[model samples]
Target: MNIKELPFEHVTVKALDIFNGYEISFVIENQTFHFLIGKSEELLPLNIKHYFKNQEHCNICQKMIFPTPFGQQPCLPLQKDMKDLLSHLRKTYVVLT
Candidate 1:
């Protein structure tokens, strides 16, 4: 499941404080489901791994970035997309389930 290949009709990404990661919530097969992933953690998914592996990491000294595995810092556009997803989720995330 490549992160980029996920046909996210609707999705939400929230940063997790206790674990220092993020939770991805979305609907699939008519069921609401969630997946958790952490930065610099062993449990990082293969999808994220594969996705980041194919991307170009930030080489410049000063720039907003989304850090990936092995000290790779990709730019912040991907992070921005995640924020947009969160906003979309909030519009429908009324129940605190």
Candidate 2:
């Protein structure tokens, strides 16, 4: 499903620790959905926006330097971090119509 199709009205993000991880929460149709991200040891100089930007590439460096099973791909840490959250929401929280 397209993320744009989700009924999200607003989003809130909070830093987790000095390691530069974050917790992202979404407000969808008045209900709250949340997810946590751990620090990336591979990516140096972590930034908060990395957890929020909506793009296939890293918003900070604008480079496709991150490694993945697919090969060195565009940095999509936010997308990767949301994987479990999206699945959990799809299975238990989000009400599809």
Top lDDT: which candidate number? 2
For residues 1-97, what per-residue lDDT tens digits would candidate 2 score against the true structure? 3554556555655676665665556654443334545556532222122222222443323554323333223234434445644445446544322
- Over 1-97, each residue of candidate 1 has an lDDT whose tens digit, in order, gives 2234434544667777887666665643333334445557333421121122223333222333232344343223334344444434445542222
Error of 2 at 70 (Å): 38
In model 1, pairs of residues that clash are none
Q: Evaluate all candidate structures by whole-model CA lDDT and list the values in order.
A: 0.41, 0.44
TM-scores of all models?
0.36, 0.39
Q: What shift in Å separates residue 67 of candidate 2 from its native position after superposition?
A: 39
Model 1 segments more than 4 A misplaced: 1-7, 41-43, 46-97
lDDT of 2 at 47: 19
Q: How well does candidate 1 score on lDDT at residue 83?
A: 40
For candidate 1, the C-alpha RMSD (Å) to the true structure equals: 11.4
